[model samples]
Target: MSASTPGHDDPVRPLPGWFDDAKLGVMITWGLYSVPAWAPLDDRLVRLLAEHGEGADRDRSYHAEADADGFDPIVTTSYSEWYQNSVSVPGSPTWHHHRETYGDRTYADFRDDFAAAVEQWSPEPWAQLCAAAGARYVVPLAKHHDGFLMWPSHTPNPHRPDWALERDVLGEFRDAAEARGMRFGIYYSGGIDWTFANLPILRADDVARAVPDSPEYAGYADAHWRELIERYRPAVLWNDIGYPSAAEPEKLFAHYREAVPDGVVNERFYAGTPDFLTPEYATRATSGGSKWETVRGVGLSFGYNRQEDASWTTSGPDLVELLMDVVSKGGNLLLGIGPDATGRISPEQDAALRELGAWLAVNGDAVYGSRSWRVAEDRTAEGLRVRYTERDGDLYATFLDRPSAGVSAPPRLAGAAHAECVWLGGDGTVGTVTGLAGLPVPPVRPGVPEPTVLRISPAPDPR
Candidate 1:
């Protein structure tokens, strides 16, 4: 087997064919944070250095009580999924918010609140949305860093025996998703369970140090991993940070495969190369050496963040482009949606998903089960961004930007008639597109979000 180096494609690849065909998966990161659903996604301390001129009495002071204007895109953008750990830092933004809002209430309070709230929420809607969005699989957070289990597991949390949810969240989600023809996955915070770690994280270096490597914690995490497989039989075991250093990676992989034959794992296990490498926020985008994925929240925060306005999230058109980009680069896009404690997908998130599903309804043939083309991206004569995917012998060219009235057939496919050209949500036969004059003026309304997909076949040889 060949692997990719810094420059060229390697024949050795780490992904199973099912993963390559998957192309799109949905990740849900709901947990205790969903209750408060507060925190930024950025590495703010990095930004603070630039703001305060490099260690010059950095402003550890909290910003305005509510979502303030001029929040640094670099600073405000952060993973809300780690709210529990961030709040433990005492002076961190989440810490300040927790102290001020809940007034010294332990994280356990928020955990209980989430568990109570989830009792009223159902998993059906989440399943329906993933199906609608054309997700190949649905991965829900089973046990996040808060050490809270969504499933009623025999493997007790080393910290709290009574802490597990009464409801079988993973089972319900698995049934719901499988009912909709989507594979089920589980996200486990295997490396760092903050309840046991309990160490303050002031810096990136502190992050790794905080994972409790004690035999007790390792044994507990190992049991949870095995129990998850024994019960749910997830298709994907998405571990976070890393696995317990003591656990045997080979044994774990063997067990996962035995439980669910097609089961795959992510690179975060840190034991060795995983079935896939995951890049956050955007696609890894390196060519053909390995199976890779880009997992990102619809908004800046993975866990729901009330502070996120419309500006923080990827719009419908933008998300389509993102998926196209990732697919073109031989990767999958694990688009994340953070539901509230009540398990409601917020309106902002819901709208984008609906639009994505609608788009996929028409253009899915170009995405699902498609392989990366030799050349990933090119441009049309009209300057529209074009991404390529191949299925069978047919080539699909997806325009990143919505084509205007006067666009052209992709430049490389110049003078070539399209086998089939379709608008994202429009039916087939959009008239043959050309390089100079794009399409025959479709009946779409102005400002409505949609992209054009051109299926090009080789022009016939001179007869």
Candidate 2:
């Protein structure tokens, strides 16, 4: 297989076909900082406090207090900022702080606390919900940049003795997904671990220094990655930022493939490009020279942000429409959830997932195990637009958006001969979709908004 070069202009290539089947997935985020019982999604209290005390000479006293308490003042100060910014701490920054301060705490201190939290983290309902909604696979954050192993690691960070999370969070998620018969994937951060390396920048210091390729850092990353691939053998490896140079991720990708031959690696490894192009927080106008998956947070934030306003949540119709639009053009959707300080996903997030799952359950036949039919038509031409995807003997002519006016049910296939249309909402009938416009228009509802889908017969051939 020929891979892309640094500055080459090439058409988007299909990632392994596995991605096509992985239309919808979930990204889970949890770590030590979540134990703080604070919401950082929308709050900036800690940041405000930090700024208030920014130039104060009290920095000296703060350091003394941190040393006496075995807490890293830099971390605490940064944590404050995280809370203020979004009520959530950034992964690398928070993890580095935790390791510096409490790396000496025994598993006896937080092991059960963390494990119990994960053991009770029943994503089965979530998975079942997603599958019911239309997701073929589920991806969990095996480990973020915090360097706190969700699985046990033999390679210990000498600097942060007690920081390794002994419990296997990924294993639990894997079992949960398999039990539900959903495919499992793992998200790994490629770089940025202050516990094992020096990042004066995150510590609020200016040091233009290169990260030393010391044995300690190498031993930690290599051993931990080996443990992840060897133990879980994840189907997909979802990664975070910090790649190409700092971590020499291409080397890691080579190692990953050698360890897990059939495993899939994302663009975060080589550079900003992934095995599939993952558009974060937004949809892409075109596939980025590869199969694509859009990973968007439910709200403005990805992690547990106690400060997030529930009113800012995403709606089921909008999300469903987004999925349809992407899948219609051949793409996948990766949704995210931030586990709270106690390792619990917020109720609001759960509701949003459930809503999506409900929508999927009703109209899943059109989504799961399907291929994009390359019909070129404008979605905005009318309220309801025609897009076809085929699976088995059925062709799905999905409505790009909602219906409007008296457009009756779903629009007909553009050039297909003699087919019946059935509304996915439990009604099976060929309703009135006659229009020269080649789309349907439904009567608008007063307040309730949802994207309606109709399955059309006489499936189109890929050729």
Candidate 3:
């Protein structure tokens, strides 16, 4: 297999088993963007034509907070100037909207807010909510491209506080989760950070552009990774944007092993291989046949998409079905939740989460600790049903679509002597399995279409 990142010529390390147990998680993304929750750049402009003409400052809060945080007020106030001059007018597709709205604010303001907000954040309730929603773990953004550290950090990011080093956000979150009996994880952006002049690596011309192998890159990596790993000791360390500019990932992995020997890492960090495979924005109905996870926000944006994009909102029922489908296929689901400026989850999002929790209370047993069945597909009474996993001698089958009424057929079964059928519901309800004596199965729709389970006993394995 390929080494982790480019030039990472080293032996691969073994992964841990707890990763298998972490089948579901909640990803939180909140930062400076959450302040104005800026609207889409193009569309918001037309809507703001009126405000702009009136000199109302389409982008407010430019330098007020930055000044308060002791940021370079003059340089910071010109952020909107830069956006208007460099991006919007020139069609540069810059994060013009983000810069215009929040560019002036320093990381200091966000840090104070984050620290205070996180302190008020009731991890107990949050973990309870996730557990209720059937999540095995919760992954919060430890650091984003903006370079703001959620936890205390003595080596502050010029713009934000060192709460990462002082307040111990990671420790508090971990303690909260353990107190609530749930696992904890973190998300870190690998290469970019607005505070770091070298950020926006894709832009290429932002800074002197040091390669990964350069001493500068090495120093940067060593410092950040060392602090995160040793301080947090996260169960899961998910990296975004990928690593390996000029340096080798083996060196980084070496640090990961030293700091968190048993922790699990995702593949986004320069290597498409980690403890599990990750699919963004959609659920995998089919088993990856390997350890995997599907990550996506409830809506189109991961963080607080101020516009409230309809595409990002996954209905409660849809969320439940998707989670069930993925788990049946032996894959995990990492759902994202966006928080507003006040650090509050949207009412709709919170309700959806609670609704998923309600469903999990009923059908989670059919999900947790389950193994995918050898057989991949089955013809059912409703239509075509896919067999995903097994739990306590029961076969769980998921219907791809709603079936028409009056159809009747027995789904194809894997090798088994006999079987009993039941729908996987909140209460353990069993339905009789009739008409399996022949082939050419019946329609699956009107005959309890969603996801149903079949109870089967296999012959004992010869020792």
Overlapping backbone residue pairs in candidate 3 total 31
Q: Which stretches of candidate 1 lie over 4 Å from their true place?
A: 1-14, 41-77, 415-439, 442-448, 459-463
lDDT of 2 by residue, 273-304 (tens): 24665544445443223566666567544556
Alpha carbon lDDT of each predicted model: 0.71, 0.54, 0.54
lDDT for model 2, on a 0 to 1 scale? 0.54
Q: Which candidate is the best by lDDT?
A: 1
Estimated TM-score for each candidate: 0.85, 0.71, 0.71
Number of the top-ranking candidate, with TM-score as the measure: 1
Ranking by TM-score: 1, 3, 2
Q: Is 1 or 2 the stronger prediction by lDDT?
A: 1
**Ten-residue region with minimum lDDT total, candidate 2:** 1-10
Residue 393 local lDDT, model 3: 60
On residues 39-137, what C-alpha lDDT tens digit does candidate 1 reach at each position? 754544234323422112211212111124444322232667667667776556787888889896887787678777988888899999989888998
Q: Which ten residues in a row have the lowest lDDT in candidate 1?
A: 1-10
Cα deviation of 257, candidate 1, in Å: 1.3
| Model 3 agreement with the true structure over 1-463: per-residue lDDT tens digits | 0001222122144547566656678887765546544333233323322232212311121121222334322222222212211222222333455455567654345555555555455556566667766677888777765566666654555443353424555677678776766677888766545454443232222212322334554455456666777776777878764564544665666677677777777766655336665655434445544466767667545676566644346677678667766676667888888787556777678878877776566556656777766554455544555445666666655544443443344345433334454444423333333442332222333312244343333311111
Residue 46 C-alpha lDDT in model 2: 30
Q: Give the number of colliding residue pairs in candidate 1.
A: 11
Better candidate by TM-score, 1 or 2? 1
